[model samples]
Target: MNINDIPNKSFKTVYKGIDEMEVREYLKEIKQHIEELEKEKESLQKIIDEKNENLNNFKSVETSISEAIMVAQKAGEETKRSAEKESERIINQARLHSETMINDAMMKSQHIAMQTEEIKKQSKVFRARYKKLIEAQLDLLSTNDWEELLEYDKDINVEAQSKVDNIVNNDDNVNN
Candidate 1:
């Protein structure tokens, strides 16, 4: 017979020899076994509840870890954006400085060119004046009329004195 059929054969044997005292004793033993099984079931239920509580705690920790990761990612993104903005600001500042330097250099070059042109004009005027003075002195030296030359020299000296006086007076007026 199969192992499953053994319990049925034992049950039949027990029932056929069943005296009242023996039956009472068997019933008492079965009742005690049933009570013990009920207690074991209660203990198993308690163990299951504890395991469920531990699982819930693990789920809470997992959720917290996930939230922390999300926060860290957001902060990293913000930091990257801030760094990019700072880099852009630095580039813009450099561009602005470059433009300013170029403009200043251009202005300085224009000023220098203007000054050079003015100096050239002044030099030309001084050279023409010097040539005229030299020609006048040479003509006076080659002249045969000494009295006329002396008179001319006196007139030139008077004109020179007048120009000096005018320059002095203008300087005084400007200072005042």
Candidate 2:
């Protein structure tokens, strides 16, 4: 069934059957091996969940940035339109001031365009950096460190619990 059931497993023995102690030791090893595998599975799942959360956060930020850029663009367009209308009205009254006002409005529009470009550039860089970070984490997850627990020496008697403890300690140290 599970790890607990492995060690507690009972096999009927006749006078010429297998040794009970040897079978139990094997079952114990199997149980410990399953436990180690489960721990590794849980650890990997947590890492994956964390990475997924980070990805979700990144998407949210990207959406917010996009929305902000749209708002900025809309505002810029509206300002440009309003300035053109005001310039038209001023030109009907005084042609001299209308030219200066139109030039100022054009400069404002250009400045907004420059700022939008900078924001887009920053968003691209952030996305690239986040992608690299996720790739590095995936690479770390695929490393040989996970298999070290399965490579235990069979000659040792009480090494299973100690190895599990060491792995837990190492994980704790890393988390801290």
List CA RMSD, all candidates: 14.9, 66.0
Give per-residue CA lDDT, model 1, range 24-123, as digits (tens): 6666676667778878989999999999999999999999999999999999999999999999999999999999999999999999999999999999
The positional error of residue 174 in candidate 1, measured at the CA in angstroms, is 59
Q: Assess every candidate by TM-score.
A: 0.55, 0.47
Runs in model 2 deviating more than 4 A are 14-16, 95-176
Each model's C-alpha lDDT? 0.86, 0.90
Best by lDDT: 2
Candidate with maximal TM-score = 1
lDDT of 2 by residue, 147-169 (tens): 66456444253577788899999
- Angstrom error of the Cα, residue 30, model 2: value is 1.4
Q: What TM-score does candidate 1 reach?
A: 0.55
Report the CA-based lDDT of candidate 1 relative to the real structure.
0.86
